[model samples]
Target: MGHVMQVYLGDKAQLEGVIGSKDEALLSRLLDAAATEDAVDPKIFRAIIDGGPFDEDDADEYTAAMYSICSILGGQSIDSVVFHFRSCPDIADIFYDWAFEDLLPPPEGSGCAIWTKENNAEELAERTADTGTDVNDGGEGDEVDDEIHWMNESLLAGKDLIFFWGV
Candidate 1:
Protein backbone atom coordinates (compact mmCIF):
# COMPACT_ATOMS: atom_id res chain seq x y z
CA MET A 1 0.00 0.00 0.00
CA GLY A 2 1.09 3.59 -0.46
CA HIS A 3 1.64 6.02 2.42
CA VAL A 4 -0.91 8.40 3.97
CA MET A 5 -0.75 10.88 6.87
CA GLN A 6 -3.37 12.72 8.92
CA VAL A 7 -3.16 15.35 11.66
CA TYR A 8 -5.34 15.74 14.77
CA LEU A 9 -5.95 18.33 17.49
CA GLY A 10 -6.72 16.16 20.49
CA ASP A 11 -8.56 12.87 19.93
CA LYS A 12 -8.62 10.26 17.17
CA ALA A 13 -12.33 10.84 16.79
CA GLN A 14 -11.46 14.29 15.43
CA LEU A 15 -9.20 13.02 12.66
CA GLU A 16 -11.74 13.41 9.87
CA GLY A 17 -11.66 17.19 9.97
CA VAL A 18 -7.90 17.24 9.42
CA ILE A 19 -7.31 14.57 6.77
CA GLY A 20 -8.45 16.90 3.98
CA SER A 21 -8.65 20.30 5.65
CA LYS A 22 -6.27 23.24 5.50
CA ASP A 23 -4.25 21.66 8.33
CA GLU A 24 -2.87 19.40 5.61
CA ALA A 25 -0.63 22.26 4.65
CA LEU A 26 0.87 22.29 8.12
CA LEU A 27 1.05 18.52 8.15
CA SER A 28 3.13 18.70 5.00
CA ARG A 29 5.46 21.20 6.56
CA LEU A 30 5.72 19.20 9.79
CA LEU A 31 6.72 16.20 7.71
CA ASP A 32 9.45 18.30 6.19
CA ALA A 33 10.67 19.80 9.47
CA ALA A 34 10.56 16.44 11.22
CA ALA A 35 13.17 15.30 8.70
CA THR A 36 15.63 17.64 10.38
CA GLU A 37 16.79 14.76 12.54
CA ASP A 38 17.83 11.28 11.62
CA ALA A 39 17.04 10.80 15.31
CA VAL A 40 13.86 12.34 16.72
CA ASP A 41 14.10 15.65 18.55
CA PRO A 42 12.10 15.39 21.78
CA LYS A 43 11.40 19.05 22.43
CA ILE A 44 8.04 18.57 20.77
CA PHE A 45 7.76 22.25 19.89
CA ARG A 46 4.31 21.34 18.75
CA ALA A 47 2.92 18.38 20.66
CA ILE A 48 1.37 15.51 18.68
CA ILE A 49 -0.84 12.51 19.22
CA ASP A 50 -1.20 9.31 17.19
CA GLY A 51 -4.29 9.17 14.99
CA GLY A 52 -3.86 5.63 13.58
CA PRO A 53 -1.55 2.69 13.27
CA PHE A 54 0.85 2.60 10.35
CA ASP A 55 1.02 -0.58 8.32
CA GLU A 56 4.55 -1.89 8.77
CA ASP A 57 4.97 -2.70 5.10
CA ASP A 58 4.40 0.93 4.15
CA ALA A 59 7.45 2.35 5.92
CA ASP A 60 8.33 5.48 3.98
CA GLU A 61 9.58 9.02 4.58
CA TYR A 62 6.20 10.02 5.93
CA THR A 63 5.97 7.12 8.35
CA ALA A 64 9.57 7.58 9.39
CA ALA A 65 8.83 11.21 10.07
CA MET A 66 5.85 10.21 12.18
CA TYR A 67 8.04 7.76 14.04
CA SER A 68 10.51 10.55 14.67
CA ILE A 69 7.82 12.70 16.23
CA CYS A 70 6.59 9.92 18.49
CA SER A 71 10.02 8.84 19.63
CA ILE A 72 10.89 12.30 20.76
CA LEU A 73 7.69 12.95 22.66
CA GLY A 74 7.34 9.50 24.21
CA GLY A 75 9.83 10.20 26.91
CA GLN A 76 10.99 12.86 29.32
CA SER A 77 14.13 11.15 30.63
CA ILE A 78 15.78 9.80 27.51
CA ASP A 79 19.15 11.21 26.51
CA SER A 80 19.32 9.86 22.99
CA VAL A 81 17.40 7.44 20.80
CA VAL A 82 17.85 4.92 17.98
CA PHE A 83 15.69 2.62 15.89
CA HIS A 84 17.12 -0.77 14.83
CA PHE A 85 15.86 -1.37 11.33
CA ARG A 86 17.21 -4.72 10.16
CA SER A 87 19.40 -3.11 7.50
CA CYS A 88 18.50 0.55 7.25
CA PRO A 89 20.46 3.31 8.92
CA ASP A 90 19.09 4.96 12.08
CA ILE A 91 15.80 6.84 11.92
CA ALA A 92 17.71 10.09 11.53
CA ASP A 93 19.06 8.89 8.22
CA ILE A 94 15.68 7.57 7.20
CA PHE A 95 14.25 11.04 7.81
CA TYR A 96 16.79 12.55 5.47
CA ASP A 97 15.75 10.16 2.72
CA TRP A 98 12.33 11.70 2.26
CA ALA A 99 10.53 9.45 -0.21
CA PHE A 100 8.46 6.32 -0.51
CA GLU A 101 9.53 2.70 -0.15
CA ASP A 102 7.92 -0.63 -0.99
CA LEU A 103 9.44 -3.05 1.56
CA LEU A 104 11.68 -1.36 4.09
CA PRO A 105 9.76 -1.75 7.33
CA PRO A 106 11.22 -1.41 10.82
CA PRO A 107 12.64 -4.46 12.62
CA GLU A 108 10.50 -6.88 14.67
CA GLY A 109 7.83 -6.71 11.99
CA SER A 110 6.99 -3.31 13.46
CA GLY A 111 5.46 -0.61 11.26
CA CYS A 112 7.42 1.79 13.51
CA ALA A 113 9.45 1.63 16.75
CA ILE A 114 11.08 3.97 19.28
CA TRP A 115 14.08 2.75 21.26
CA THR A 116 14.84 4.82 24.33
CA LYS A 117 18.37 5.79 25.30
CA GLU A 118 18.46 3.26 28.13
CA ASN A 119 19.30 0.17 26.11
CA ASN A 120 22.48 -0.70 24.34
CA ALA A 121 22.28 -1.47 20.63
CA GLU A 122 21.85 -5.20 21.21
CA GLU A 123 19.32 -4.67 23.98
CA LEU A 124 17.45 -2.20 21.84
CA ALA A 125 17.15 -4.75 19.04
CA GLU A 126 15.87 -7.35 21.43
CA ARG A 127 13.40 -4.95 22.96
CA THR A 128 12.16 -3.97 19.53
CA ALA A 129 11.64 -7.63 18.74
CA ASP A 130 9.77 -8.19 21.97
CA THR A 131 7.60 -5.07 21.87
CA GLY A 132 6.65 -5.65 18.26
CA THR A 133 4.46 -8.58 19.21
CA ASP A 134 3.09 -7.40 22.55
CA VAL A 135 2.99 -3.63 22.45
CA ASN A 136 1.14 -3.21 19.19
CA ASP A 137 -1.50 -5.81 20.00
CA GLY A 138 -3.98 -3.24 21.45
CA GLY A 139 -3.85 -4.48 25.03
CA GLU A 140 -2.64 -2.95 28.26
CA GLY A 141 1.10 -2.65 28.37
CA ASP A 142 4.08 -1.21 30.25
CA GLU A 143 4.30 1.62 27.73
CA VAL A 144 1.88 3.55 25.56
CA ASP A 145 1.92 2.06 22.07
CA ASP A 146 2.02 4.72 19.42
CA GLU A 147 0.52 2.20 17.00
CA ILE A 148 -2.70 2.51 18.95
CA HIS A 149 -2.38 6.01 20.45
CA TRP A 150 0.42 8.43 21.24
CA MET A 151 0.45 11.60 23.39
CA ASN A 152 2.61 14.66 23.54
CA GLU A 153 2.95 18.00 25.38
CA SER A 154 -0.17 19.64 23.96
CA LEU A 155 -2.35 18.60 26.82
CA LEU A 156 0.03 19.92 29.45
CA ALA A 157 1.20 23.00 27.61
CA GLY A 158 -2.35 23.98 26.73
CA LYS A 159 -1.36 24.22 23.08
CA ASP A 160 -3.87 22.89 20.62
CA LEU A 161 -2.61 19.39 19.86
CA ILE A 162 -1.70 18.42 16.34
CA PHE A 163 -2.37 14.70 16.31
CA PHE A 164 -1.27 12.48 13.44
CA TRP A 165 -2.32 9.27 11.70
CA GLY A 166 -0.54 7.13 9.09
CA VAL A 167 -1.73 4.74 6.40
Candidate 2:
Protein backbone atom coordinates (compact mmCIF):
# COMPACT_ATOMS: atom_id res chain seq x y z
CA MET A 1 0.00 0.00 0.00
CA GLY A 2 1.08 3.54 -0.60
CA HIS A 3 1.66 6.15 2.05
CA VAL A 4 -1.48 7.68 3.44
CA MET A 5 -2.28 11.22 2.43
CA GLN A 6 -1.56 13.96 4.91
CA VAL A 7 -3.62 17.08 5.37
CA TYR A 8 -3.00 20.24 7.29
CA LEU A 9 -5.25 23.15 8.20
CA GLY A 10 -3.60 26.52 8.17
CA ASP A 11 -4.47 30.17 8.57
CA LYS A 12 -2.86 32.06 5.71
CA ALA A 13 -3.11 35.31 7.55
CA GLN A 14 -1.39 33.88 10.59
CA LEU A 15 1.27 32.26 8.45
CA GLU A 16 1.86 35.45 6.55
CA GLY A 17 2.09 37.29 9.84
CA VAL A 18 5.09 35.23 10.89
CA ILE A 19 6.83 35.16 7.54
CA GLY A 20 8.68 38.32 8.36
CA SER A 21 8.91 38.11 12.11
CA LYS A 22 12.12 38.90 13.97
CA ASP A 23 12.69 35.30 15.12
CA GLU A 24 15.18 34.03 12.60
CA ALA A 25 15.56 30.71 14.43
CA LEU A 26 11.86 30.00 14.20
CA LEU A 27 11.85 30.94 10.56
CA SER A 28 14.86 28.77 9.90
CA ARG A 29 13.34 25.74 11.55
CA LEU A 30 10.05 26.28 9.79
CA LEU A 31 11.79 26.46 6.46
CA ASP A 32 13.79 23.34 7.16
CA ALA A 33 10.79 21.34 8.25
CA ALA A 34 8.75 22.54 5.30
CA ALA A 35 11.50 21.60 2.90
CA THR A 36 12.18 18.12 4.20
CA GLU A 37 9.98 15.02 4.02
CA ASP A 38 11.47 13.39 7.10
CA ALA A 39 9.52 13.26 10.33
CA VAL A 40 9.72 16.63 12.00
CA ASP A 41 10.57 16.88 15.69
CA PRO A 42 7.49 17.29 17.84
CA LYS A 43 8.89 20.26 19.72
CA ILE A 44 9.99 21.95 16.52
CA PHE A 45 6.65 21.16 14.96
CA ARG A 46 4.89 22.73 17.94
CA ALA A 47 7.03 25.84 17.80
CA ILE A 48 6.59 26.10 14.04
CA ILE A 49 2.84 25.81 14.22
CA ASP A 50 2.76 28.20 17.14
CA GLY A 51 4.39 30.90 15.06
CA GLY A 52 2.71 29.97 11.79
CA PRO A 53 -0.89 29.21 10.82
CA PHE A 54 -0.73 25.40 10.96
CA ASP A 55 -3.26 23.95 13.43
CA GLU A 56 -1.16 21.23 15.00
CA ASP A 57 -3.99 20.04 17.19
CA ASP A 58 -6.08 19.04 14.18
CA ALA A 59 -3.51 18.06 11.59
CA ASP A 60 -4.01 14.64 10.02
CA GLU A 61 -0.50 13.50 9.23
CA TYR A 62 -1.77 10.09 8.23
CA THR A 63 -4.94 10.03 6.19
CA ALA A 64 -6.55 6.96 4.67
CA ALA A 65 -6.41 8.18 1.10
CA MET A 66 -3.16 6.24 0.60
CA TYR A 67 -1.98 8.89 -1.84
CA SER A 68 -4.67 7.86 -4.30
CA ILE A 69 -6.68 10.85 -3.12
CA CYS A 70 -4.10 13.00 -4.82
CA SER A 71 -5.01 11.54 -8.18
CA ILE A 72 -8.68 11.98 -7.39
CA LEU A 73 -8.08 15.56 -6.24
CA GLY A 74 -5.59 16.45 -8.94
CA GLY A 75 -2.42 14.41 -9.53
CA GLN A 76 1.01 13.48 -8.28
CA SER A 77 2.44 16.70 -9.66
CA ILE A 78 0.97 18.53 -6.68
CA ASP A 79 3.17 16.63 -4.26
CA SER A 80 4.91 19.55 -2.70
CA VAL A 81 4.25 23.10 -1.47
CA VAL A 82 7.55 23.62 0.29
CA PHE A 83 7.78 27.34 -0.36
CA HIS A 84 5.07 28.21 -2.85
CA PHE A 85 1.87 27.32 -1.10
CA ARG A 86 -0.98 29.52 -2.18
CA SER A 87 -4.53 29.87 -0.93
CA CYS A 88 -6.78 28.11 -3.42
CA PRO A 89 -10.21 29.27 -2.33
CA ASP A 90 -12.13 27.14 -4.82
CA ILE A 91 -10.58 23.75 -4.04
CA ALA A 92 -13.53 22.41 -2.09
CA ASP A 93 -15.85 23.59 -4.78
CA ILE A 94 -13.70 21.90 -7.34
CA PHE A 95 -13.66 18.64 -5.41
CA TYR A 96 -17.40 18.71 -4.83
CA ASP A 97 -18.06 19.45 -8.44
CA TRP A 98 -15.99 16.55 -9.60
CA ALA A 99 -16.98 14.11 -6.88
CA PHE A 100 -20.68 14.93 -7.15
CA GLU A 101 -21.42 16.55 -10.48
CA ASP A 102 -18.85 14.54 -12.49
CA LEU A 103 -16.98 17.52 -13.86
CA LEU A 104 -13.58 19.24 -13.70
CA PRO A 105 -11.30 16.22 -13.87
CA PRO A 106 -8.00 16.44 -12.10
CA PRO A 107 -5.58 18.92 -13.57
CA GLU A 108 -2.66 17.85 -15.79
CA GLY A 109 0.00 18.08 -13.07
CA SER A 110 0.26 18.63 -9.35
CA GLY A 111 2.28 20.47 -6.75
CA CYS A 112 -0.11 21.33 -3.99
CA ALA A 113 -3.77 22.37 -3.70
CA ILE A 114 -5.46 24.45 -1.04
CA TRP A 115 -8.85 25.90 -0.18
CA THR A 116 -9.18 28.96 1.96
CA LYS A 117 -11.90 31.05 3.64
CA GLU A 118 -11.96 33.33 0.64
CA ASN A 119 -14.92 31.28 -0.54
CA ASN A 120 -18.45 32.03 0.56
CA ALA A 121 -19.45 30.00 3.60
CA GLU A 122 -23.12 29.94 2.68
CA GLU A 123 -22.25 28.55 -0.71
CA LEU A 124 -20.06 25.89 0.84
CA ALA A 125 -22.82 24.96 3.24
CA GLU A 126 -25.13 24.50 0.30
CA ARG A 127 -22.66 22.32 -1.58
CA THR A 128 -21.56 20.32 1.45
CA ALA A 129 -24.92 18.66 2.01
CA ASP A 130 -24.55 14.92 2.49
CA THR A 131 -24.28 13.17 -0.86
CA GLY A 132 -24.92 9.78 0.72
CA THR A 133 -22.00 8.30 -1.19
CA ASP A 134 -19.37 5.89 0.02
CA VAL A 135 -16.56 8.16 -1.03
CA ASN A 136 -17.39 10.67 1.67
CA ASP A 137 -19.87 9.14 4.07
CA GLY A 138 -18.74 10.34 7.48
CA GLY A 139 -20.54 7.52 9.28
CA GLU A 140 -17.77 4.96 8.70
CA GLY A 141 -15.38 6.60 11.17
CA ASP A 142 -12.58 5.56 8.85
CA GLU A 143 -9.58 7.75 8.21
CA VAL A 144 -10.77 8.90 4.80
CA ASP A 145 -14.19 9.88 6.08
CA ASP A 146 -12.64 11.50 9.10
CA GLU A 147 -10.26 13.40 6.84
CA ILE A 148 -13.12 14.59 4.71
CA HIS A 149 -15.09 15.61 7.76
CA TRP A 150 -12.10 17.52 9.03
CA MET A 151 -11.67 19.20 5.69
CA ASN A 152 -15.26 20.35 5.78
CA GLU A 153 -14.85 21.55 9.32
CA SER A 154 -11.73 23.48 8.46
CA LEU A 155 -13.39 25.15 5.54
CA LEU A 156 -16.40 26.02 7.62
CA ALA A 157 -14.20 27.41 10.34
CA GLY A 158 -12.70 29.94 7.91
CA LYS A 159 -9.38 28.12 7.86
CA ASP A 160 -7.44 26.92 4.83
CA LEU A 161 -7.12 23.26 3.80
CA ILE A 162 -3.76 22.31 2.35
CA PHE A 163 -3.10 18.94 0.67
CA PHE A 164 0.49 17.87 0.17
CA TRP A 165 1.40 14.51 -1.31
CA GLY A 166 3.94 12.46 -3.38
CA VAL A 167 6.55 12.62 -0.65
The lDDT values for all models are: 0.34, 0.39
The residue-level lDDT of candidate 2 at 165 comes to 42
* Candidate 2 lDDT over residue span 37-130, tens digit each: 4444344434333443433342232111212223332322312222322344333333322110111123222223455655534434554555
Query: Count of backbone clashes for each model?
Result: 4, 4
Candidate 1 residues 1-167, lDDT tens each? 32322323232223223322335455555556666744433222122223223344333333444444333333232112233434333332323322222223332222332222222234434655775634344455566433222223223322222322232
Candidate 1 global CA lDDT score:
0.34
Q: Which window of ten consecutive residues has the lowest lDDT sum in model 2?
A: 96-105
Number of the top-ranking candidate, with TM-score as the measure: 2
Q: Flag regions of model 2 displaced more than 4 Å.
A: 1-4, 16-23, 31-110, 118-123, 129-148, 155-157
TM-score of each: 0.24, 0.37
> What TM-score, to 2 decimals, does candidate 2 have?
0.37
Q: Which residue pairs clash within candidate 2?
A: 77-110, 77-111, 78-110, 78-111
Question: In model 1, what is the error at residue 29, expressed in angstroms?
Answer: 4.0
Task: Count steric clashes of candidate 1.
Answer: 4
